[model samples]
Target: MTALSLEERFRTGDPRALARAITLAESGLDAARPLLRAARELAAARGAAGTVVLGVTGSPGSGKSTLTDALISHLRSEGKRVAVLAVDPSSPYSGGAILGDRIRMLRHHGDSGVFVRSLASRGALGGLSARTMQVLALLEGAGFDWVILETVGVGQSEVDVAAACDHTLLVVTPAGGDGVQAFKAGIMEIADVIAVNKADLPGADRTVRELLAAQGLGAHDASTWFAPVRRTVAAKGEGIGPLVEAVLAHRAYLGAGGLHARRAARAEFEVRTLVQERVLRRARELSGDLYARVARGELDADAAADALLAGA
Candidate 1:
């Protein structure tokens, strides 16, 4: 129960210890600082630097959860330890994760090599929980061979997963005009691999062609990594092997230098986000009358924000 013992258990990959550490990280308490620091150090010492952190994202009804479940099975079959962080929309009243993903992945519950945790987005703009990065570091430190991040259904601007993971897998469906939507400027650009799930449905081939055409329209050259569009019927576990192969191919393309660059970008994003969160919290605490002034039209919004920051 002591901090040192907890860290020791965590180093040994104790499941309970990992769970406790993640809860502390999610709490955002000052007490979590040393634990998180130790995790980072342990990860580096263990040579877990090559651990793949895969991000799965898409709009609602895209079968992301089902695809993730298949991935977990495939990875586990290969004798690899895998951890999944499923980010779900927060409940308005309780501000807790809906737990839908956990329920769907119940078959993996007793597997020692598989760890799945659901996180509440808590109003984060990018469909990811603010504590996701820290928790991901803990998972890496816990020695999982792979870490999968499944984001809440995302839109064009909710592509933060690109900065948070080694590779971003954008999932789309064959029906519902998702093919056109997937080619939009923002989300499409971030995808390292795109999965057209529900391939058994109508328009599957058309969707594939549209996605391939969209790739052609992008400003990609021979040196650029073009996202591969693969079709899958995740519910039946069909086409998952090729999807996994595509992901690994993308990883191979990234190479060592490119992977390091992506991790560096992820580190920068975490630092900036933490700084912005702290500053906003401080500003909120000090804006007793500034909000009233703005509401009363006594001070303009921009000026009030400046004053709040100054005080913070």
Candidate 2:
């Protein structure tokens, strides 16, 4: 249909319109600018200050997808309309999501209140699609009470999710050596809530202790938010209640002022990232000959970069 009709339908929270809007958004900033502008205006008009955007990230094999599935079930049970943006690694050849949406989250297939979409990371080092923030705005404008961003779980570089969501959940498994690795990766510092999934396994209690000890190492005052470490057997839906409660508590801790600050930071990040992307695109367009010159030793790498920027 026409763009105006699509925007109208999206304003009414039509699921089909939301899906189409996300697809258009993924295309690129220029292709989706009008629609995204509309979404931003709608969100501002609605004063969607309480919208919950949760970012779930962790190392690979941390049961992140299963945890997300369980989270969807819990939120749905609580009568919240939820939308999930699952970022999967891109297939090198096809540039498509390697793990498609249909394969996971199968039970929510027919749920009108829930929307699940898989995005190809497209080789983004941050483990999220380049256009993820734009698509999230569309979801928010479409009236989803909660939006969940499940990243590619690429260990060290997955920290970008913290800037994109209101709260970040880091999932780890017992006996997986995650305590040390997460510390080294700096993911621990970014997590607002930590979940030890597969808690029924051996060494679960030890893992919990290790996390608590790690938290102790960081200096904190009365105002500090000590990220709660919760145990969960997500596959069996065990301990999901406490995990959900922890997230809600964290949200409460943020309050309206804190949430607004975080959202403002996110908007700044989004704008900065878009500017960088556009500049890089322009650099690539102008640097073809500069690259050849550098390869031929006719110009130094730094000089080539200077020329590129000058041209930009």
Candidate 3:
């Protein structure tokens, strides 16, 4: 389709067109740069403040899909036009997602008020597809009030995804074992809210207490409303309401002033990353066999480094 038609489709909230637009946006700069820049400019001109981007991240099998389904239902029941973008790890062998969360979220399929899309991480290491934020903007411009970004729980990348959102919720299970320790050092710090999934399990309370003690982020606070530890049996939809409330409250908290700063930072970060990618692409285009020569010891490594750095 033509650019205008594609843009119109995105504006009209056509899922097929949204998928195509995002694909173009992800397939490197040549295909996406101009359109993405124009889209951002349009967003600025229209003064379309983004929807509440809620990022949910945690360990694998943490029941994130179930939680997202319940959360989406809750938001829809509240008359919110919601969008769920679940980012799954691309298959290492086939480079496609093995499990599509959109299928699992089909409970809202008949509700035009709710939209769900699944994105493959596409071998992107940071738990974030480079096009994620742009796609989110597209969704907001389509009039979605709430956008939930669900990520595969894979350490640093998941943390990066969480940092890109207005509010970050972490889902964990009671028997996380040593996984909790890793979170303390990394993911837990970025969480605005935490939920212990499978709360019906034996040691649910203990897990919550451990998380609180580990992160010092308790429920009662004034400075930075401490991350609340909610219990949810997502399969049964228990405690999902409180989870949704926490997400909304966090959005309000961030929107007051923090949202602007955070979004600005995310925008700057994306720009820098794109610039870096462009520079590397150009360098590779110019270098050709020179890199191979250096690797094969036909050229001095230091000299190659110097030459590449000079070109950069």
- Give the best candidate by lDDT: 1
| Candidate order, TM-score descending | 1, 2, 3
Q: Residue 76's C-alpha lDDT in candidate 2?
A: 94
Per-residue lDDT over 248-267 for candidate 2, one digit per residue giving the tens place of the 0 to 100 score: 89988988777778777778
Give per-candidate clash totals. 0, 0, 1
Per-model root-mean-square deviation over C-alphas: 2.7, 2.9, 4.1
Give stretches of model 2 more than 4 Å off.
1-4, 29-31, 44-49, 89-96, 100-102, 123-127, 155-157, 292-298
- lDDT minimum window of 10 residues, candidate 3: 39-48
In order of appearance, the predictions have TM-scores of: 0.90, 0.89, 0.81
Candidate 3 ranges with C-alpha deviation above 4 Å: 1-20, 27-50, 89-96, 100-102, 121-126, 217-222, 283-306, 309-312
Q: Tell me the whole-model lDDT of each prediction, alpha carbons only.
A: 0.80, 0.79, 0.72
Candidate 2, pairs of clashing residues: none
Deviation of model 3 at 312, angstroms = 5.3
Error of 3 at 260 (Å): 0.5
lDDT: which is higher, 1 or 3?
1
Local error of candidate 1 at residue 29 (angstroms) = 2.3
CA lDDT of 123 in candidate 3? Answer: 33
lDDT of 3 by residue, 231-306 (tens): 9999898999998888777767665467767666668756665566556666777797988898898999888778
